[model samples]
Target: MEVWLNYVFGLRPRNFWGLVCIPLFPLLHGSYQHLTGNTQAFLLLGWFILMQGIHLFYVVTIATALISGVGAWLFGPPNSVGVGASGVIYGYLGFILMYGIVSGSWIALLLTLIIAVRDAWRITGNKYNESQLLPVERSPRMGWTAHLFGFIGGVLIALALSDMRLN
Candidate 1:
């Protein structure tokens, strides 16, 4: 019975909610470039989490993604299409911060501060095109909100699922 299940969904696949939200990404953004950029970052950070352990990684990613995506949809402007794994990335930030706090390790602490600062830097400035303001849909939804909520969801899930120590 267990073997048959593994062949199907590939085991629970952490944060299952997030994976289900991937398709909604196209609805959120109009430009392929914007989507691609977020997707690339998501893939990289996702790998970082995966290295920790498949089950833990999957659970955090999926859970954060779902919570963040739903948050965006609910809190974001009306009629706005929303999608992207940025929230999951944000959730990672949340997890890292809490993980460092819980474990009090230098690596976890430094990594969290470094990543959080770097991302904060990017979203602070507006990327412009010559003289005209671009469509919100075409622009990268680079903001701290996703990371904010991602962190919230991450801490909640991480705490509930297991004791995470970033060693």
Candidate 2:
């Protein structure tokens, strides 16, 4: 059902309508396998974001989704449908990473570094890394475009919001 919803609402690369699907994209998944892959990042990152504050969490989530969707829609492979929360997870990762540097939060920086090393290690050894890296462009495969865009989005949002009293 969610998958079907994804087909109906997922972001279409280079399509203007994709903007409408930005917020919705995070709510849909390509498959159970895809959903499962994203679940841990979503929960863990989401928890950490919430730890900052409910409002910050909401702001980061929505901003990342919108920015990620725009990025995928504008720069992703044409005529393709992209859906998943991995982008948002990437956004969370980016937010934490940038938050540490911008706000001088050592804990956030350390956590982001640890995650990056772990994921980088997995990609280096895993035969499936290529597929995961360009998943959306490859068709019926895991793509990292959303993740990249989401991370960028998160960084942008964090930069914009870090000055606020977001404690």
Candidate 3:
């Protein structure tokens, strides 16, 4: 099943159309666990991004997808097909974290800080490590590389928009 899916829909390194999978793969999930994890992160971070404004939301979303997708296609494992929304969520996380820093908004900074602390605590205090602070690449199936690249993508976009005085 995994082999079949990777061949067809997974993001393969150096594959041109697989580049399309960069944006599209985030919309796919390998299992219920994968879907729920991405959903929670997306909803929370997405809310904050949405608060910035609807137009910015669309802008950031598209930017994250393209940047994150391209990064994965260029640097991801040769034989693997990356999938899941962790990249986008990580992008959102990066945007929030950097936007606060760039804008010098105390409220945004505090909000980002709180989330950081909370995630750290969750990872440290949990008995089973149920929650993670950063997206950790635990399985060959989990695309943590995309998460990382997506985060970098978000930070870059936020930096680019910092001078616009969006805050």
Candidate 4:
């Protein structure tokens, strides 16, 4: 329902939710620490996508979640509740990085590389990237697998999620 708001604005649904609110869909934190960290990374990444003004982001988001949910169900620990936007976030990262590589654009490639490097540094257990705009404190509880899978899913499902063709 909210997705249709993008059509009114002539943008992609995936871009809107994918970059902004969708990440929150999967992993909503209960503690201030949890929410703060996610919110910070989300805001920074969000600013990047917002500049692109693509609105049909919901498709990418929905697909990523569906795929990641399946991935989590298939591979995640038994009986564990999977909730967090990390999966979709990673999916976005995968999509952007792959897009840059496939398109051969230096800017896209460079940005993707930056994001990759940062995310990698963030992923290391018991370490945090000091330069990160998001929270510097690391949570050992975060799920790296979901992030990895989600990023892969984002690339895998980008086209299926997109509302319009570039051509």
lDDT of 3 by residue, 1-167 (tens): 75466467777778887976665787777778778977987888888889889988888888887777787788777877777776677788788788878888788889879877755543232554333324555444545566667788889988998964444
Candidate 4 or 2, higher lDDT: 2
Better of 3 and 4 by TM-score: 3
Ranking by lDDT: 2, 3, 1, 4
| Per-prediction CA RMSD (Å) | 9.7, 3.0, 3.4, 10.3
Q: What shift in Å separates residue 108 of candidate 3 from its native position after superposition?
A: 0.9
Better of 3 and 4 by lDDT: 3
- CA lDDT of each candidate? 0.55, 0.74, 0.73, 0.53
lDDT of 1 at 36: 78
Q: What lDDT tens digits, residue by residue, belong to model 4 across residues 1-167?
A: 33333223211123432324333446544346655765676666645554555463555556666666556545554433345566666666666666556655577678879888776654443434322113322443344446656767867654443342222
Per-residue accuracy of model 2 over 1-167 as CA lDDT, tens digit each: 77678788998886767777777887788778778877977888789889899989999988888877788777777677888887788888788777877776667677768877766632222545432433434434555677778888888988887775334
- Pairs of colliding residues, candidate 2: 135-142, 135-143, 136-143
| Candidate 1 lDDT tens digits, 121-153 | 333334452111111333433334444566688
> Each candidate: how many clashes?
8, 3, 0, 18
